[model samples]
Target: MASAKPKFPAIKPGGSLILAWQVKGKHVVVVGGGEVAAGRIVHCLNADAVVTVVCPTSGLNPEVAFRVSEGQVKHTDRNFEQSDLDDADMVLVAIDDPAASTAIWKLCKERRIPANIADVPPECDFYFGSVHRDGPLQIMVSTNGKGPRLAASIRKFIAKQLPSNAGNAINSIGNLRVKLRSIAPDPAESRKRMAWMTKVSDTFSWEEMCKLTDEDMDFLLRYYPENKAPSFSELRIAQGAPDPQGVDPFDGSFGFSVGA
Candidate 1:
């Protein structure tokens, strides 16, 4: 007899799927103007998308609009209709009305437009994740649309640990890469140079580097190779007092001694 096959629960008609879409230079339509909409807009802008906002009652905050309005996003203060989806490559429906949001979702599906429903995951084609940005580096976190708040909290924690000068360090490394490539044209030599550079970067304290001038950086890069890099751990040990175990102290505890 053939073995019986186990049946699994089927996916509902509408279910959330987390996906990463390359939206660079693409048109994204946002249909709301509240804080939620603002957050989505910021993410879209950071991804270099051309955004168009449609709000029947309100528009994006003036400050946000000013910062990103260099023809990247245009606002239309009117209720959304099927016609609005004509030129939109991607759409985000964050409106308060569930019926309207559902309507837009159906239209997007019919028109073959990718869409995300901000508050309703089942009605969304894709979902946006929490993001952290440091210069050229960007980190995105997703919870599979299960717990967005948790994702945001994790992003906040990571943001705290990331150095503020991380962007500058990345830019410096890029410039160094160009210079290193010129000197070490061979792939093997270039790999070795990059390894040495990484070691130097790891050894150098970003805080200390922030105080140094461009000439100081250049001098260190030229004078100190990885093998000759200064030892920060040694400096720290030198600054600290000798361990009590190494000293011939009467006892471990110390108190004020009276000249009795």
Candidate 2:
């Protein structure tokens, strides 16, 4: 008999890989001191990158000037030079001089270093997405350099639907998970813990989970050995928590079409 067609479709190419790059302790070179460059530097600093700005001091905007004055980033008070790319793990070009920017981009290409030349998508090795941050939680929206304003709007819409305390809930859950692991170290109990945690997660709302206490956790652990999670009603009663206020679900469609 002929082979039946596969149920799933083949992977589609041509899309950027959405990733959270770990840049901590790595060197990032920013070759401008304009407003866009200031924003790029801030993002790099947030990721704990060792940032250095190479621009004439006269070119620096107020924000970039303040960052330099505070000693947050090392500053080279001149235009970019070939030696600037020597220790750079990543490069960001935000200068208005297209010829200079293109020249630097070509150098980065020869050195095989990833670079993003602002306002020139063709020259960029990567694109930045509009990001929403809440503690350890981050939501990013990308339109592949086609519609950045729309991406920002989409990010704002998503942020409104999430509970304000969602990050706190994640932190609380992490701590509880660590405590649970310390209490149940037996290898054979792994599956039970896994199942119990899964059900518990499915049953609790972000707000309810954030309110979990030590006594509540102790009571919950009693059911772990049985490979069971407490029911939503049971947990609510134990913790005196209220039902979650639901956000209207997004229909997974955009109201308006977006294009470059």
Instruction: Give the C-alpha miss distance for residue 251 in model 2, angstroms.
Output: 41
lDDT (10s digit) by residue, model 2, range 1-260: 99989889889887899989899999999999999999999899989999999999999999999999999999999999999999999999999999999999999999999999999999998999999888788888999888999999999999999888777777777776777798888889888767778888887876788677767777666656655665544644444455353322222122211111
TM-score of every candidate = 0.61, 0.82
Worst 10 residues of 1 by lDDT: 251-260
lDDT (Cα atoms) of all candidates against the true structure: 0.69, 0.83
Error of 1 at 217 (Å): 8.9
Off by over 4 Å in 2: 1-3, 9-14, 186-195, 210-215, 239-260
Going through the candidates in the order shown, the clash numbers are 0, 0
TM-score of 1: 0.61
Supply candidate 1's per-residue lDDT for 165.
73
The list of candidate 1 runs beyond 4 A from truth reads: 1-21, 57-72, 180-260
